[model samples]
Target: MKDTSMPELRAMCFADLNNAVKIIQAHDEDDGEAAEADYRDAGFDNQYVLEVDGNIVGVTGYRDVPGTDQCHWLSWTYLQQSSQGQGLGKGMLLELIEKLRSENARKIFVKVSDYEDPELGKIYQQALQVYQGVGFKEEVVSNDFYDEGENQIILGLYLRDDEDQLEEDPAVSEEKPIIRFDGLFEIAETDGAYTFSWIVKETKKLFGKRNFSVGDLQVGLESVKNEGGRKVFLTFPSNLPLIHSPLQTAGFKYVGQLQNYYEHGVHEYHFTHDLNDL
Candidate 1:
């Protein structure tokens, strides 16, 4: 490469979309196209790119966690394969952290999957190490989150001093079957259609496993179908066996499960309702 200008971090622009996605695709071919669509729909507000001499080499950003006080989930952060081993990633991320601190963001979290390639080995380990080195603590781990044997690890970093922070102790933590359906929410909308998700929580036995009925599911689906939504999705831990009959009766179809998602031997079950079929 010729004498390029110094690397600089700046807000991503519409023109930088193609280059940024290319950087992401170079790292993981499967994720590039969907990620690009996400940016177009979500708009490029806090998203940024690392540029050198007018060329984009890296891209990273964060998405706000709804209902939380300035909580955020880190977005697709990737650099060109040729740029690996350099301290550029560290510098870029630190600047982003400082930027979030300046914006008074409370906390940030990132979810990474442990996928090992047959030849390349663990693909996401470097990124995980980088996050840990920057003060992000382990929040949770879901075995087989992506697929069979591929686990997901979530890490969080406090951006501001707060009193309500967590002091989690795994040993003392008792499982609670407190199930709550926070209502129907749209997760992805594209191609003139929307895909929404519902997550079932563990309902305590005292409250009765029949806390919800087919009518509730039908009501939520009716509300979304009338609003131009195309598909409604739902997921729950397979260990919660009581939820099966009720959901099946509500016209929801069982899709599949991610083994060991909630804990060892337990899995996450997926159910979906398609409005077009109705």
Candidate 2:
């Protein structure tokens, strides 16, 4: 039987990064490199490393979601391959949850992938099971998010059940529409599926007689489809009522919302348009 003793969780430091990279690489080489780069660029102020008998075996961390106080995102939760499959992942996750709860985190979220390949699917399945076992609920599944046939699964755990007090939308000023097409970028693609993101730079500009229109959206969608994109995603603050109509007219279906995403009472809504269905 594997030892069930809890591993020591210590604040990660720049000096510990080499060991962390090795631990992550043991599971995924590309991800390990990305994690190391992210740590270097962002720093490890909120990260922690798990140590078992003075040997670094894993790493985990959390970051406050921008524009919110109570919401947080799980970051870089990884364990060495040699240390996995022995119930260590659950223990580490529980510890991380406790840490977040103690810090008064009202909600925590994480993203996992659903891959088309059976072998790759099994890995994420185990991950999803772990998160679900710890009370994480599947909140959103962005189809073709990562690439063709690989979906992004967002899970959330609410530590507190406080009811949100909805706030009224503020009056809009009559000014030139300040919106800009942030650019269309490829989100993910595979042989069977391809997804792209259309980002609207400013919501306030959505109300005025602007260059953006339902027709514009249709053209963009068609252009992407012609280029072989199977899916397209767009997100915006729910407070922008004017934006919703055009999006709906463009045949974008509402996927889900992230509550308290922008501020208390406001939300970020996710919408997707499937080219194949159209």
Candidate 3:
């Protein structure tokens, strides 16, 4: 096992972006905009680092796609080979899940390559054990998803509401039940505070993908003349990057910026369109 006892957990920033770049480069061959895009798309608030004696030895990040009703997606997690066997990956995964749960996330997803190579195969098997141990269930597969011609296995885990925990744990009363939104916000009140809170909660719950944050509102819920307006919330895949132009074509427009939006301390490009404008 690695010397995990000396590792520190902290949020990432632009200054530390180069560290993430190195991690990506070491693990994958991405360069230039591809690497920078990964950092920007990762959101400052959604990325994290595991440091040992002041050097980043591990990285993990979450993302939220804009149109997918702010579904949380797991971007990626990586640890240096020197730190591989010390249970740091499990610890990091737990930290990410717990943080998302507190932020009101309902599901988490990750993609791991399943290859035939003995060495790479062991890595995938270990990753599978880590995710499954944490409650992830196999959900889907993308044929030939990796450069090595490996298939990608997608896994999913559901987040039980706090009230569900109370009932199942037998440690508290069931009267004070926790509430979760079931796609009802479209017709709900549109106070700035509520919208802001919803944005935060939604973003938190839907980390690990690019569409995790709302970039530009194609149509404010208010602008949707009918249920057609609500489809924007469902466009998120819960585990992939966000596509901006579709929402733009739908009617959403640019708004402003949200600073330090996720736990990763990243800024978000906010957008809004008035119902009246439609």
Candidate 4:
């Protein structure tokens, strides 16, 4: 079961370019023209956004890798501070991977920046964990992949074999059945019946026992509820049937399926769509 009110994925528009530039500048201050050029090159098919309630919370784009078996690079991805926890990043990455895989890309590469400060580097390292968790392997290290003094580590992963990395990665929160209705419905401790009942339905659909409990739908809901787009994600006890039709009827697209997300056998399905299209 998923929160019907959550926002979905949508194409990044030309109007969104200026703000997208600011988002990129926040990450890398240098080479604004190059970034803009990359966005322009992508055109309509290149970039996508994760929005909720009419705001762009996350962004990602793809580019072709010439003279290599791999066709494109998942060049950029970002989520606002408010949407940090609750698996939004993971969901976005999975969406991007699905598009790349559909093109029959043998592999996808992401080279993340590494800093000099151990503490700051740790933050990048944590981000690296997310990429690694998504099937991208740390392949090489360069003294300055972005800045003159900074370092960059090249990560690579085979699309077919590495897809499971997402499922195998450790769960972000310990809260059980982190559910949300931020996209389509309001979910709080006070109104738990709708979400709880659906969880039971999904569990029965999966043919698995209801061993897991719903902990925080608001937190989970916030992850997918973007301002301009809509995305749906459902975390269930792995053995259960994961039929999230309530999400589908609400116009969500099944983007990717993650398996073995936890040692205890929890799995998740990530879905996305646009609010206007819905």
The numbered model that scores best in lDDT is: 2
CA lDDT of each prediction against the hidden true structure = 0.71, 0.74, 0.54, 0.54
For model 1, residues 1-278, the per-residue Cα lDDT tens digits are 31134365799889889998899888887678868998999989889999866678889999986544677888988877788787778777888898899998877878787889999999999999999988887766644445446666777787867543434312223333535455665553132233334454665566665446677677777888888776666767655656777788888787665433333344456676767676
Q: Number of clashes in model 3?
A: 31
- Over the stretch 99-160, how does candidate 4's per-residue lDDT look in tens digits? 77777766666657666554444446666888888777665554322334555566666666
**C-alpha lDDT (0 to 100) for residue 76 of candidate 3:** 54
TM-score ranking of the models: 2, 1, 3, 4
Query: Which parts of model 1 have CA positions greater than 4 angstroms off?
Result: 1-6, 165-278
Least well predicted 10-residue stretch by lDDT in candidate 1:
188-197
Per-residue lDDT tens digits for candidate 3, residues 1-278, read 33346454688888888877777567654432354676776568788888877888877878875543334667657777677888888888887777787777755667676766555544457778888988887755544334325555767665645332231223222121112223334412112211222222233444433332232333235434344332222222111223345446645554432221221222234344334445
In the order shown, the candidates' Cα RMSDs to the true structure are 9.7, 5.0, 14.7, 21.0
Q: Report the lDDT of model 2 for residue 182.
A: 39
Model 2 residue pairs with clashes = 147-189, 148-189, 148-190, 148-193
Model 3 misplaced stretches (Cα beyond 4 Å):
1-8, 30-35, 68-70, 118-123, 147-149, 161-278
Q: C-alpha displacement of 19 in model 1, angstroms?
A: 0.3
TM-scores of all predicted structures: 0.63, 0.77, 0.52, 0.50
Off-target runs (Cα >4 Å) in candidate 2 are 1-4, 119-121, 164-179, 188-212, 215-230, 275-278
